[model samples]
Target chain A: MLTAAPERSSHTIALVGLPNSGKSTVFNALTGFRQRTANYPGVTIAPFVGWVHRDGHSVAFVDLPGIYSLSPKSEDEHLAVRFLRGELPDAPTPDRLLVIVDGTQLERGLVLLSWVAPLHLPTALVITMIDELKARGGVLDVEELERRLGIPVFTVVGRRGIGIEEIRRSALAWEPWGIPFLPLPPDASVEERYQWARELSAAVLHFPRPDTRSERIDQVALHPVWGLILFAMVMMLFFQAIFTLAQPGMEALEAGIGWLQQMVENTLPEGILRNFLSHGILGGVGAVVVFLPQIALLYFLLTLLEDSGYFARAAFVVDRFLGSFGLQGRAFFPLLGGFACAIPAILSTRVIPSWQERLTTMLIIPLMTCSARLPVYTLLITATIPPVSVGGVISAQALVMMGLYLLGAGTGLIIAWLLRHTLLRGAKAPFILELPPYRLPAWRTVLGRTWSSTWAFIHTAGTIILALSIVLWALTEIPPVSVPPGTPPLEAQRLQLENSLAGQIGHLLQPLFAPLGFDWKITVAILGSFAAREVFISFLGQLYAIDVEAAEGTLRHVLAQTLPIPVALSLLTFYVYALQCISTMAVLRRESGSWRWVALALGYTFALAYCLSFLVYQAARWLLG
Target chain B: MGQTEIEVPLNRAPLRRQLVVRRYEGESSVIERLCELGLTIGTQLLIRRRAPLGGGIEVEFRGVRVGLRLREAAVLYVTACGDSNAYRSS
Candidate 1:
């Protein structure tokens, strides 16, 4: 909320760490709520930056992807190197780098410092996970290590916000030399550098008995049988948590959006413009926003698992399946995460050694049911499938929904199998994965990380959703034309939207859908819903907003008034089959660096959906008619 | 039911008893993966725990839970971690 341009006196600080090094937790503590999220050039991995104002200076702290070496392989790794080299788009090179190392893994994490030290940048080692180490009879001679390294090394345990302020102050106070982590003379081979680093570590470092929890956890968690069970149970719990806990909040959101639409209707002058804004924009776009709770909750649970070390074992559990699918075993984690959201999932696919596996995983990840699809599925199922009991143990409606989800998953797997033999077919890729030791769930770190990610979704991605909603609203509301209609559209279309251009287009698209049971109204809604799957509800909300059948239960009846039951089932089935998600497309473009793959995927899915729906509807009409 | 006592055909189901690895009994790509993880002879393995949806099995060895599919788990032999009923997964 600065009214004027702030002074360009802010200095950038990069926070670097090894995987699972608690660096992100400290970054969250320092930045709090001030941050920006965007994609790195030529890659999907989004780097984050946040501001911390201390004393009189604005300090911008950046969280870079964790890596073991300065050498680049993955796009994210390349971005890290480039940024360290003072080259990045939309970002000035950092003034200093903070290398955070896990104290328990000091031997391994210190390898990064040798590379960083020679660069000659003013660097500090934020020794993290110290609390875990201390509880396990481990102790670090921090002063001695600092004396040997000749850098201001701060001992930290950021999950609890401990030692965070100290590190920040030290970083703010330190002055830097011109050089950073430069290599030794050209005559010296890598062996010489390794020798020097090992000698230095031996002279200065102290390691008491390191915590063995990770090893113990790894033994049980990564075991051949039990580990797999625990991993699945954990993932299933996360999936179930989203559906179970986020429902009431979703209802509230739906109600709120509904109330707002009503408010806009009552306040605006009665015309196509007002009707279009309320029904088209608010209805079409607002529906997608309702899924924010589910998305946020999903991220919360995922971040929780990731902060703990259980996630690695889960990947280990599925490594064989990934290998069978012609994907690298490491591809399992990112693809599993793709079931939640594709952005982080695709970005994390960097662990895959080959581009083909990464591309294959990305192509099929959208086939996994994302939260965007959940809203539409819920709306449709509630409308069609009656709530009933099955042997008094299961909810019939719930079972059907679960079955549909399984169907999507099964089909996605089958599709991947087919693709492995066909279009992108290749020899199965090799696997190289790091199975890090497990740690206790740091709930504070999980919460902070979740909040940061959720904030990004709301501010950056959510705004794009909103803009699309507004444009969709205009499409459905303008034109003010006569409806050459056989069926009345949903509530959003009942307003003066009947005369708008969007309504006319919807009217025109009606016949293309009539065979599958939709009239002009449903056709219009589905057409705009192509941008996102879950928007089907809000699209209907906007479409139905203009109609009298704006209430929830009334929508199905309204559709039935136009098309037969067979057609409704066909539409539902079509939604189930077609890979209809905008986020999925964005991720595909990111992973492949080309839109061809996405276009091909979209074409194949839509073609398959239409063919299946057509056959199912026609067969049903012949029999059930 | 120990690795030394139970010697079933390589394709048949693994015995209920836990076993110590006498040796990796195959030479396919899958075996190469196991080799990469340093799963050699004298390694203790129990294949009782597994994921519900054909994900894999959990074998306890050197105090770590390693999840491997029956495809690979079949390659290991062992005595039961504990005396129990047959481990049948859904």
Candidate 2:
């Protein structure tokens, strides 16, 4: 029975490989649920570390980002090479290295192996994708390869867990192959190394012919005309799935949280503890939790796309368009993921090789109108825009919602272009992408990856949101004072909120927001929403609960009756551009690895939101009034 | 049979045309990368297609497809092996 050992006794082993080589799958098989998938390429970007126990001792395994060679061209490759050379500060030097090779592309894999060979580290080889190779009528002489390289070679179908135990044993024993370092000749060029790898592969690999299915698929998938169409269709279905499929699950989660809040409110005595648990902890965390379905769906689809080898094609298709904005084609997935949530999207930018491109993508991701803003947008659209249809087809409300989404995306692209010419000016990184052969995505791999990502989000962001929610709750309920006799409960609650710290801060900021057509109540909601965009809706819900006449009315109904159209439109525009989520700022700090960038991002976005909202409000008043 | 091999830029190579890499005329980094990706002299390459709207070119070599920018593709000098029926059949 395998069990996790004490961390102090765990030996570290690093799994290295070329891109698309099934290294991550092998790591998943060895570590089980103990692993977390960071889903990015750099060593520091998403260090996926897992531990496996063997005979009372545990071995820590790190799945490093895939690279083609030791020579670093991109940031990810640089980090990977540095980590392998034990030059990365604060990272534990792996006691051993397990190099995974793609059996189907043995020659290419051998080139990378040769580079690792000169390092003379304690290393072994696990040849993967053997099933795909066998399907193409190929056979690899694993024993012969082991003899030629003087290393232990294990053949594996990582997706199905074949030969996982043997690899585990090899890691546990910490056996170095002791293969003599095959040093590169002085002044040897990449061609010479390629020749060497070719000779090595010729010695052990036998295949009747190249696999034709992948070629056939690529003909359609990479065709300039049809590929773009296919990509668009695939993306359309992907977004539709996220919106439609996740709807029921999101609703269920929301209802479940609401029920829990009500239960605690009813069962617990009415006190600070009850208030904190029901409103602060439950409400704040629930806002983040309801988004789990969308996040999970996004990861699941992305994993499938990645596993099937279509993502590279998609990147290739979009390279030209993204290049104009000073972003690499690889930034497409992260930006698309941004539509679901910016946190995972920022983490996903590790796939971009250039530091500038990755940073630019991170800066613009929050502008992608994440699902968090949906509730706010929906509420505003419902309250302000009529349900009248144009030509009996498009609803005015739906059009406004779509326009807001486009506004967010358009502003992001324009900013990307501006940043590229000014702050991020440099020669564009040369585009060199390898189109991996298409394969059927394994179900277990996709599910395991999605589960790990969902767990990571809940574990990391959930705690911060919960803590902030509690702090906000305290701010809303301070300076213990009772309502005066004969005062209406609604007015008393309003006065209590107005007198609280959160309310006072809102009042202090009212003058600043006055230009944008927001009153103190709206100002308070905006401040509260800094914890998360969705919090704006919940905060409004709480505020409306104070008005006895409007207490029984829905928050949307109350807002519809109260706020003028210009103010409502202004607020909608504000949410479109504001960096109103603390979790996003926290994620930015972590991903960019600096507070300066976070502060700059926060400062600029707030300014942009305020200026834009003020302009929209003033223009609307001039045009309509 | 050195009949003054007719060389053309890789980007100019017609789709599905088989050619042999003569030399890379690009920057050192591009040359190094091309060599690392097994596009060294004497390697066979088939131009798959030009990306839509002049984005890049897709070249097939060694059972793999590599997408290269048009400028990078222009640096590769290839000698067209006129109508290699045997290569196509294979």
Candidate 3:
């Protein structure tokens, strides 16, 4: 749904620029509309589409993937080239073009412009980072550039919102804008086009000094040993912030959900409506929503790192190690994002240029212990493991949690190695990444992206999760059984559940899962968790007739009493390896563009889950005996 | 004089030295990408810094900095031209 095509507008402008040319900054500054992710039919990583409205005029602008030239090489660049030429099906051909150029790199920008000149589209030049240029003793004569290229030129500082409104006003008036005049022949060679760009740039742009500050920073930031140390420090800080900084926010959200549940209970009468409202709706969604703090922080920190230009250096630092494993440095971000949520992490693998490497990266992302699995892991560890300190340093429960994370990450690496050698093996693609100059992160962009990603999470909770919760409620509540009027509430609920559709399905699957030490009730909750990992806790709460909001303490107590240590450990092992998230599978299908790969991924993960869980259960049983 | 202009792969080129692109011998896709990034023949480039642990080398040309893996860099043949300081604006 996020990548649906944009609504057609009367007039559309396509924004084209090289990567790190501040193209997204300009798009974010000008467009007030909610951005829609645009996925062209054969494109793996889609462009962004948004609308700019002013003075009763609205123009849809598609932000094409950053490309250095129109000559198609990569899949996304081919899509960009085709989209500009009106060749892509199911996507509207743009009416005009906004050619964005980095103020500091006019010559390189002109090379790209040279390719676009032949398209004969109504093109206007947008010069970003003008401030960075001037600070470095560079001169860009916008009027001279306009005269030289026969294109309207405007300079804007996207970070500070400088001249944004003027660009918005003129973006809709492309009819009178100057189209680039190509002096060279239509069949000019690459060398000739570059020569033309060089002459044109020399005439209009001048840089008297190099970016000494960036070079100085890179001395340490890109240093072999120090650079790696710094990279590790940054990663440590990132994960540390996610856990420490998000705690208070998570607690507040939990308390808010608890209060809302209380309000609903006081207002609604005792019956199906009350039970559904408090336990079904609130319980199911609240469990997922509590992780909102971690999700928001993850995107916030990632955006900051990307905008500040440190991510590229980190990738550079790790390229050798990751390359040894048949994955490139760009895969690092998606794998790290997997820790927050595999849905977004899988989406992020688009940065990798190679199809084989990208597929390998995507296949391993679900094994990285996403935040959705955190609640399930915590519950099991708290229930099965003792709280005694390990060597008087860390609690055994904490140690178990850390061990599970390491296991997930370790297993993901091993599988990546295997996939690279077997199913997805291919020659490595060229790793040529531009390292943009570091600058202060734009707060507006950071906060906006955080809100959008967080909003996406809420949307998921409201739709897919809500629908699944309703289905779970219906499956457990239907075919209600009669009980004595004086019977206990918990017993009555259990009786009704045993007769419901879910109970029947669970009974059917229980024998299959018996090797893993799971009972019928656990089978039911495990099945419900396929919608999302966090739903397991709510399902267990529902089956036990406990309010999920306040069930954390009681649920742990109840689980410890009802479940043996072996079963709990086995279940934890299952979650560590199972591909349980439907949303993740959906994203994997869309990204890989093949349901066959999805089936393969599902098969492999399920096999791993079953085999490891069976082994753990049997070993535990033998040890206890 | 022609013999004096020895060509070396960019990955083996000395750090902070200005070099001219002689030719690229690699996969067509890789060569095309390099040209599109303005590494066409005769364009002057400087090896700004080499990443630690053989990660890659940072190459600067046309005032744009790009990180290229050693494998990709090894495909680009370059001839040492002038001092890096003299080609500051390349």
Candidate 4:
């Protein structure tokens, strides 16, 4: 352990369970919103630790990863076992442990119970999914199972928050340790476990007999071909839905921002403060307003998928394709979330076990059409690509939108393949999926998480970006233009941002960027956008406002009008291959242990962006000209 | 029939007899998982539904809904007894 807290207790309870066995719901039930501390070591798939009072004393319930055994193969599985064994930093072994099992599938869920019993960590069992067994025509001899295992068992329907009082009661009465002796002999290896799983299952489990029409249909649904297709469609629908539903709200936001900017303009004095408030603040802030709907919607959709168990299906579908590039099936969920933003997505990669796998997953996630890319795409598509109806079903612009998404996917795969072949070469992690059972989307859970994420984005735009915009405005506008007496000040030199420190620096770096088609103004915007992508829009907004003579839409129109098609295309391509967001870099620093990987990532991406953009522009013009 | 004999025995009149997965159609991460879960051709499979909407159908493998794409599902050869018993059926 690299660190431990000064006031830490020597006891921690790690909740272990199989997927969809109500591990999370149980945590929520026990925690009930009072949980704040993160449990998983180095995993941002951080589960909430809801403190419980057992018999007038405080006990912390740590929700560990959902796994089936102590014979750890994957990182999450290993972590779950390790934390229980008191290996993780500041993570202590439980005074009492709860082994949550599926009420319906005790045989399978008990796979872990049998393995971990010998290790002896104050074990008890909360058999979940009792409601489902009733719904699906299966019966559980709960008392018999509990007596045989020599542990207390409580039946729970975790979502309704049911049986939790009894759970608390058991926690209070728990011996602070348990000893479960198997009537049968124990096998140690995975090979032994596999055989034990079969033998033990035959002894205790009785699967609901499959006879009805539905069973046959499921056989096909599980089919590789059909399943893959369905998976693709689900993702396509999600992306299509995110963009589709966001447009109207996005338009309303644009109107609202325009109105707000006009209000600021009318109210403020026509000076540095006013320009800062109106053009710098409003323009920069307004760029994000158009994207709020998409961000909120994407977060909402992704949280639901992650919570409701559909992500597992989608992951299985793409697992094959991702494998070709050296990523595992687990990367699917992270990339799926990356479409909206990379913050949570990158954080989620902690659930990925291997550092190499996690790095590959993290690196590729930013490519999946993040909501940041939305404003740029919408701006370019509206300006350049005309939306014409194709075949009365597909919009030309929609097709182009699909192509852009595909391009991101293509680029991500290529990068992963490159990493696999070059810097990171090892056996691809074996695919292990914990397929959670189908369940209704937890609306409360989803909404709380989604809104929290939305609020985080809002907080970022309101603070960091807001402060930076003000600083940028000042950087571009200081020294109060001392013009020669009597000359209405040469309009160009009165536009003397050159006198300002920003313009001088922009001019200095102009030569290096010239080949990539970036003029001084574009270079300035690029530098500002390094802070945030949407800052590009405001960068142009503020730059043109500096020229004073440039009209509304003049900067946007300037790029469209004055810049060659090659330059505009180059800028677009540059953003397409743009590396991590600033926040992504910070998180990567925390995760990767050094800035070297971050620099390598940025250097490679920049070089890739420049070469790719140059080739694209030169080729497009050659083909057209 | 010869191909059917390659993996598992087919039911009489090609009834969709349950078979555990022997292996996946393609050697990918997904196929490997399906095989590990006793969802191969010989394992007893409960064919799920082709969702009324698009995407894929749901299948019950080792008592879980394994949602497979149309392409993957197609390679799966099954002996169905003219029953519409899809996955998720009561």
- Please say which candidate is ahead in TM-score: 1 or 3: 3
* Full-model lDDT, candidate 1: 0.64
Q: What TM-score would each prediction reach against the true structure? A: 0.79, 0.93, 0.93, 0.76
Task: Write down the TM-score for model 4.
Answer: 0.76
Which ranges of candidate 1 are over 4 A from the true structure?
A1-8, A38-43, A176-197, A280-285, A328-353, A385-399, A482-499, A514-517, A538-553, A558-563, A583-587, A622-625, B1-90
Each candidate's DockQ: 0.07, 0.52, 0.72, 0.09
* Candidate 1 residue-wise lDDT, A1-625, digit = tens: 8588544367888888766777788888777767666565754556788887766767788888776566654566666777777777766678887888877666545656665565556777788877877876666778777766666778877767788887667655545422333335533433344444445555554544533566566556655566667776887787678778988888898898899999998899967777777766777556556767776787787677767766656666676666676665566656666666655566567656456777777767766666666666676666665577899999877887787677667777777778888887886543334455566666666666677777766765566566666676666545555555554544324654545666677788788777777777677667767666665665566555533344344665554354465775677667767766665566577667789998987887787678878887899788886
Number of the top candidate by TM-score? 2
True contacts kept of 3: 0.85
Q: Order of candidates by DockQ, top first?
A: 3, 2, 4, 1
Off by over 4 Å in 3: A1-9, A38-46, A72-79, A173-175, A456-462, A544-553, B1-4, B83-85
Better of 1 and 2 by TM-score: 2
Docking class of 4: incorrect
Residue A164 C-alpha lDDT in model 3: 84
- Candidate 2 TM-score over all chains jointly: 0.93
Q: Candidate 3: DockQ? A: 0.72
Query: Of the true interface contacts, what fraction does each candidate have?
Result: 0.06, 0.52, 0.85, 0.01
Model 2 chain A: weakest 10-residue lDDT segment is A37-46
Q: Write the per-residue lDDT of candidate 4 for residues A1-625, one digit (tens) a residue.
A: 6676333333456788876677767766766655654534554334446677644566678877776556454556666777777766666666667888766666556666776777666677887767776766666666666667777777888777779788876665444444776654665543344445456554444545533433444344345577556667777889788878988998898788889888987898756677677757876677555667877788788767767666775666566667677886678778877777676677678767667888877777767777777676666655555457789999876876677777887898898898888888876554445446556766655655555556656654445555565666677677667656664333433365555667767778878778787898877667666656877766565556634345445555554555576676677787877773676676666566579878877887788788977787788678768
Local error of candidate 2 at A435, Å?
A: 0.9
Which digits, one per residue and each the tens of the lDDT, describe model 2 over residues A218-300?
77877667877898999899888888999999999999999999999899997779878998889887877998999999999
A274, model 3: CA deviation in Å?
Answer: 3.3
